[model samples]
Target chain A: MQFTSEQRLDDGVLEREFTLDGIPGVLWTPGSGSAPAPLILIGLPPLGLRKVYARVAARARYYAAEHGFAAATIELPGSGERPRWEAAEQARADLRRVMAAGEPVTDEIVDALVLPLVERAVPECQAALDALLSLPGIGGPVGYEGGVISIGVRLAAVEPRIAAAGLFAGSFVPAAIVEEARRVTVPLQVLLQWDDEANDRQAALNLFDAFGSAEKTLHANMGGHTGVPRFELEAGARFFARHLR
Target chain B: MQFTSEQRLDDGVLEREFTLDGIPGVLWTPGSGSAPAPLILIGLPPLGLRKVYARVAARARYYAAEHGFAAATIELPGSGERPRWEAAEQARADLRRVMAAGEPVTDEIVDALVLPLVERAVPECQAALDALLSLPGIGGPVGYEGGVISIGVRLAAVEPRIAAAGLFAGSFVPAAIVEEARRVTVPLQVLLQWDDEANDRQAALNLFDAFGSAEKTLHANMGGHTGVPRFELEAGARFFARHLR
Candidate 1:
């Protein structure tokens, strides 16, 4: 409810940057809201919610404004405005040592090191949803959206409130998510860049197959990381409109 | 190669146990060697070259005996007869800490911690090949085979000395292996139990797709990890026969 600043993007999307209940976030609502709008909860891209994801945020805004929805991006726990967890630093150090020795990043190391931070992140996402949904002019059904896509995967699996999901397959999936995917029955739209150099294409495909959703579609294009085609993004926005609108 | 014990497994397969060049191994050659025959380098199942993997070892022996090939199993650098790598334990402990905190195992963790151990394992495999090829009765083309499966994945990617590989898709894949898989042009037969609970099904399928080989066949059956039927094993043996014989 309390925004530190409010600005109008060139395209007329209303952007309000806020530190709601100690969680930092940016909310994009229509310049002229006439009724409660469907909400799109955007996860941080791999580069965090910074300049790198500006186009992403814009896309979310453009889609929402065009489709009569609201899009919001929050700082997950241990990221953005929040302080980094000590364990994350330790995990990074552990990773560096193993990489120096030319070892593969194994699951156990992921479970121990990176999992904790993301697990904590899940709750933070829930909190962001709570805060965003309660805003004066923000409303209607909510859909989980965006990349670093595993968090979206986790949210869709556990949060029954998520009416739909549009996932970007650009992150490593933990084994737990494979199990989680089996429990996710929500309608989903998973987009993948077929040849992302930094991504394990197999893992992405595996997570997509694990979804228990009968109404899931995988949209894949041959591109590297940061090379997701615009057509796919439109397809995803169209999907959310069908489900969430 | 010096033997410590020899046994006949009721099927005319001669099994010889030995500690050659500080590596513990079991060598199985058919009771009849009419001419110089092929050698199959069998990797260990998730269990070391221990009692649990005995049946697996036996299957290799039985196949080798029936098909007029020589099969041998060797303990990897960190399992069975070899001293454990100190770094692996530290990595495991690090993984435990993260998992205890309910973290999702991410790819970076695998790259840092597990890669070194598996990287070390690759050379040990080469060493085993060098030793196996040097034996009096062992001869002709060599096929690298085994599971938990990434070891086989890793070996197939790098060891051009291997004429053929029968990889079991029953383990998590590090991202590096996806890159490595591209380098594996060896004629390959990859086996998978389609419903393996402990295995990441997506990762398995992805690695299979990543292989650059034109002669690769995916032998997937509808079953759990331990439920791969006897017929599939035979099919794998048949593949080796076609490629390595």
Candidate 2:
């Protein structure tokens, strides 16, 4: 999963691509840094392409460059430029293909689809984790953080290698899954929004309680389920710096 | 003010009454500790009835007793069983009279008239604060914490005797007011919820950047509009215990 710092595109956005355990991913990496730094993976749920994710990805690239970290915003399987759903069954089968290929898909999908279909995709998520870990400079100890949903957090938590993990505006999975996720020993940060419609305050509270870590930090900010505002970035950055290292 | 343990109700479902500076209020304390606590001030905006206030008050009482803190649920001037309003202007007059009298009215009156007339009853809010601080154990160092809507926090902050103050989920106030509030040197904890609709997260961030106190601790939670969720009580309790004392 070695992400190369390549030149900006015609639109003046930096771009790069890499292959993780044979799964190729195009990365938008900022070029201002030379050292190997922390990497961020951008994922969107099964919804249509959202420009917000791109904007956030761009901001992440900027932050990574400014702070001297290697950042990669990748389009997940069946997302962004690779949308492959026409019928529901086709989408499920497509996801199964990705899972069979050993890409990392979150349990959210596994729980949503039939057992046979999920069984096929389980290895994909593992492979994705492997691909993510295989990226140059991403090895050793790594931290994963996300806010769109609980998918990313769940994915990161199951991987024993993620040293630290954080979730902002995350939804809660089934109680059993949450219980399993709580077993993750890494330092965990859960950020919740008060007025979020998709995942309301109660969901956040339940997730926080489920974590069962006395050291787990629960931050309540003013955003919906999207992302954090810019000014608040410093606090989040400080938290990440303080704990991730 | 010194709040005696006797003044505190039992953990199970219960009801009690209080007269703060002659303002009478019935506290409804619930038995189960599952519900989230509400800071039910009877005389605040969105006026309702005495029974409503009483129920909310009881809930607050129960919440405080169960959670080991105090709950202040008040009654407005004209909403509940106290009286009825002939018109908006009459309601205004009634509010003035209530504030001037400094007597506790039923939750009905407080909700219907008192809260709606807050801006005109600025002096009343101040007087209430004074009376509140005059209570047995409330004396020493009064601090305020709030978000974008900071009338309550501002009142608490400007008081010279307040030991410390913090604002979370807050919006920008007038410079003079902020300057005056900043003069109070106490440990401050500002929790900003980024991406809020009413008060932009960037604005809160900038305010935090310009605010006073080297002891200031800024945190970003994932929420909007309404303040942090109840689960944050863990952080809030720890913070207030450390600073308010």
lDDT tens digits, residues B80-140, model 1?
A: 6578877766776677787799887777666656578677777877887787788777775
Which regions of candidate 2 deviate over 4 angstroms?
Answer: A1-5, A9-14, A19-24, A28-35, A48-53, A81-129, A132-139, B1-245
Clashes of each: 20, 54
Instruction: In model 2, state the lDDT of residue B16.
Output: 52
Candidate 1 lDDT over residue span A1-245, tens digit each: 46999988777788888886777788888877688888888887534567545785777788756776788887766655577778776776787798799998888776666467668778887888888888777775788877556677778888877999988776546687678788888888777666678788778768877888866756555546777765556556767777876
Model 2 residue A73 CA deviation (Å) reads: 3.6
Q: Chain B of candidate 1 versus the native chain B: what TM-score?
A: 0.91
Quote the positional error of residue B10 for candidate 2 in Å: 50
Q: Ten-residue segment with the worst summed lDDT in candidate 2 chain B?
A: B37-46
- Runs of candidate 1 exceeding 4 Å displacement: B1-245
Tell me how each candidate scores on DockQ against the true complex: 0.02, 0.07
Leading candidate by TM-score: 1
Error of 2 at B124 (Å): 16
Using lDDT, give the best candidate's number: 1
